[model samples]
Target: MEHRIRHLSTYSYDPAALRVALRLKLFPVDHEGQQVESWKVTVNDEEVSPLVFSDLGDREALWSSEDALDQLTITAEGIVSTRETNGIVRGMPGFAPPGIYIRETELTEPDEAIRALMGEATGDDTLSRLHALMGLIHERVKYLTGSTSARTTAADALKDGKGVCQDHAQLFIAAARTAEVPARYVTGYLQMEEETEELLETHAWAEAHVDGIGWVGFDPSHNLCPTERYVRLCSGLDAFGASPIRGNVLGETKESLEVSVAIGQSQQ
Candidate 1:
């Protein structure tokens, strides 16, 4: 399916006397089952510097310079090609180290419960093992909106027995890692069953590295891999790694952010 995506992230400062820098991962790239037609990003404030390059993972680091700043806005729009390959990731150059995704971070870490949850070993079949893992996690954690925050870890979300899509994706990543599978977090857009004329903004999921399949996508939230209706942007170890948009500051101050997203289908 062909899709048109728009994402606008704006930040407002309480007092306009500080500097801001931004990192953007808002552009979509050609992936196993998806293609990017055209994408662009524009900044509202010239005070904020442009992005810089960094060799971290699949994503690029765009760093903004430190200068006097207040409010900042980053907007992105483009067309995306999406499909479902049943988690079959193909045509990737090389393999990412397992440790790069499993290391403990601010929002991702396998705790006692995660360890115990993943302790029940399964067979070696990649698809079957992933399916079993999905069942176990879905049964363990209930799906509820607004039950967890972006900072919530897999253990915490699992304990709460409910969380949003991000939490579900993170939990799946953590569980897959504990099971010795290399999984990464995905950020993208989802088309729900709403009758409204506007499309939703972004979505999250997990992709595991299978022996012969490379990377296979999985959405524990829906217990399925990404279909043609889903548009993928970027991925990382966790949300932090695949944040749609991020910023850094020289000094501390109060800030407010407002986001608006719209997705639509286009004539191919």
Candidate 2:
């Protein structure tokens, strides 16, 4: 499957004058099941600066404004071809050992509820158990937008019983780690066959390392493994680490952010 994607992020400053620095990981990963046809990143409507490669295999573009600016807009657009590999990530360069993913992050720290959820994943096979856990999470947490914020932790989302894809992925990672299965957070784009009022192009999912199969993606929010419709961007210990955009602002001024994303099947 092939997909065309467009993402626009705009930042507006209240004082209309502030210095800003940004790091972008908007580039898609080129791996065995995914191929990048064409991709580009632009800042303030111009081509991005030189890119620096990271150890996690993501290309980062750094941009800064020394002059007073009212707003900054970053746009990333590209076409990508993807294949369904049963959610298995293979033949990709490994950045960290599987055991490293078992370490807990602040957002994924497990509580009693998460520990109990991990215990409910009953199966002799690790793969099957993980699948069961995914189902459990889907049932436990209802998908409701605006029900949680970026600061929401796994335990908090579980207690609320409602959250978006990010919350689902975080809880899944926490539970998997509690079960001694190495898991990491993934950020990507999900192509929707038909646009809907509630549809979002950006998506989040969890990948757990199976003893025999390596890393496999599990989207508890959708209760399914990633398919060709998924375009993986990057992975990390948690959402904060895997965020597509990270930055800082100099000078004291209010900031407002707006993001728009579109992903659809490309015409041949």
Candidate 3:
């Protein structure tokens, strides 16, 4: 599938002051199952060029300005072609190591419930157990739109029994890690449905490092692996680490935010 995407994020300041700096992770790179055809990032209608990839193999850059303004907008637009690789991520390098994801973060700390969940993933082998775990999570948590925030942790989300994609992904990571399986958080874009025209946000999923097969993707909330309809963005120990954009504004009394996203398939 060939997908065209546009994402616009705006930050507004109440006092409207001095400076703004943004750390960006909006660029997507070509990998085994994904290819970036054309992409660009812009600030306030002006194009930004020469974004550098981080040491961890992420396309990242920093944008800053000193001019006082009411709002700052960052826009990323691109065309990408993707294919289904049986949920196996390949040909991507420099991610520290597969074992590193075994470590936990604040957002993915496993509690009693997650440990119990992991214990319930009964199977003859690792892969079977992961699939069983994903099924368990899917049945455990009910999907609720806008039911979670950035600070919501896996334990909290699991206990609450409701959340968005992030919650499901985090909970899966937490549960998988409890069994000593190497797992990580993944951020990306998902074409919700063939008839769906646009979306207001990106998607989240989790990846577990299987011994012989490498990293395999899983989405507990949706109960499926990422496919041709999904566009990979970045990965981290948790959602915070994999966030597409993080920023700070100096000299602003207060701040507000608005985001818009659109995704569509190319006719040609």
Maximum-TM-score candidate:
3
| Residues 40-118, model 3: lDDT tens digits | 9998887876477765558888888868878888899989999999888888856567777899999999999999999
- Candidate 2 residue-wise lDDT at 73: 94
Q: What do the candidate models score in CA lDDT, each in turn? A: 0.73, 0.88, 0.87
User: For candidate 2, what is the TM-score?
Assistant: 0.95
Candidate 2 per-residue lDDT over residues 1-268, each given as its tens digit: 9988888888899897568888888888788889989998898877884377776657778888879888999998889999989999887654767898999999999999999998998897999999999999999999998899989999999999999999999999999999889999999988765562223547999999999899999999999999998889888889998898898888888889888888877788
Model 1: residue 141 alpha-carbon error in angstroms: 2.0
> For residues 1-268, what per-residue lDDT tens digits would candidate 1 score against the true structure?
6777778787887676367766777666666777878777777733222244233334443646456667778778778877777666565433556456655555768888877776663656866787777777767788887787778888899888898788888888887887778888989887664642364447898888787666778888888877777777778879888897877766667888887778877766
Structural similarity to truth (TM-score) of each candidate: 0.86, 0.95, 0.96
Displacement of residue 223 (Cα, Å) in model 2 is: 0.4
Off by over 4 Å in 2: 196-201
Question: How well does model 2 score by local distance difference test?
Answer: 0.88
| Candidate that beats the other on TM-score, 1 or 2, i.e. the better one | 2
Cα lDDT over the full model 1 = 0.73
- Compared with the true structure, model 3 gives a TM-score of 0.96
Query: How many residue pairs clash (N, CA or C atoms closer than 3 angstroms) in each of the candidate models, in the order given?
Result: 7, 0, 0
